[model samples]
Target: MFHVALTGLLTGLALIVAVGAQNAFLLRQGIRGEQVLPIVLTCLLSDVVAITAGVAGLGIVLERWPSVLPVAQVLGGLYLIAFGIHAAMRAWKPTALTTEGGASLTVGKAIVLTLALTWLNPHFYLDAVLMLGTVANSFGEDRWWFLSGTLLASLLWFFGLGYGARLLRGLFARPSAWRVLDSGIAVLMGVLGVGLLAH
Candidate 1:
């Protein structure tokens, strides 16, 4: 069980702690002290449902229809590349992250955006539904335990990011830091995207 849980946590972090739309939005909100409760819950719950679905049976589908996975891979790769480009653009032309001047979205708008970020992105499906599911299957009967671990990782990350971001509020106040972080995200996303296509 420890092994399964540890595997789940580590693997979960590997997938969850990436530069993506959901994460970036969460960080921004965290810094702003906006509608954090609803947004954090939405993100955490979204991951729970997605990761659970992936572990439940998506892995089986991929295993049975090998052809399906390649398509997912291609789509995921393209999406990542596009996401990377967006991040790169942000890095190049970063706006000052001002607590006072940024758009203060309504609760409804925050929830709507959170949902869109989580569900609309094809990469989310590839990661939470296909890739994680595929990885969970390797644990055999212990896959559920692995799922739990993965779930915990997501749980921790969202909470940590949502709440912990305040600590970095000072650091992110400067545009240079944001630029560097965005640039790093762009590189990471680009590399992962290219790796997917190459594979």
Candidate 2:
């Protein structure tokens, strides 16, 4: 059981460590110190639901649906591309800093954006649901333990990312720093989208 859980935790972390739109967004939110808790919680909960679905056989079921994959892939790719363009525009357009707190982006927007960023990507299903589920299934009776470990990993990662950026808020206060960050996010999203389309 211990070995199974360890394997699952490591596997989950390994899958998540890759730079993606979701991670980029979380880091930005952290740096801005805006809607941090809600964003983190939404991401964590979404992962829990996704991973649970995988463990419950939804992954395999989805895999069997070939038509659905391509559609999801296209939608996800397009969404990423759109988001990348938006970020790029923000980077290109310099904005004046306001002392009356940062511009109100709203928690609702953050949650929606986070969900779209995380869930819209079909790669998420491939990694979090399909791949993880397949591996967990290999454990037979110990699969539940493996799922628990994976969940723990997800929780730790989201919380760390969401709160960790707050530590850098001071650095991000500079307009130039925000431009760089936004530019990086734009590039990442575009690259990921292109990669998805190619695959």
Worst 10 residues of 1 by lDDT: 94-103
lDDT of candidate 1 over 1-199, digit per residue (tens): 8998999999999988976767877887787688988999999899889889889887567557767656756766777678779768877864533543444779999998788667755567778888889888888899999999998999899999999988987887787777776787688768877876876
Please identify model 1 stretches exceeding 4 Å from their true place.
62-97, 172-199
What's the TM-score of every candidate structure? Answer: 0.72, 0.93
Clashing pairs in 1: none
Q: Rate residue 112 of model 2 by lDDT.
A: 96
| Per-residue lDDT of candidate 2, residues 1-199 (tens digit) | 8999999899999998778999998887777777889999988898889888998898889878867778878888989999999888877776623112345569899999999998899988888899998999888889999999999899899889888877887877788887888889899999888877877
Of candidate 2, the 10-residue stretch with the lowest lDDT total is 95-104
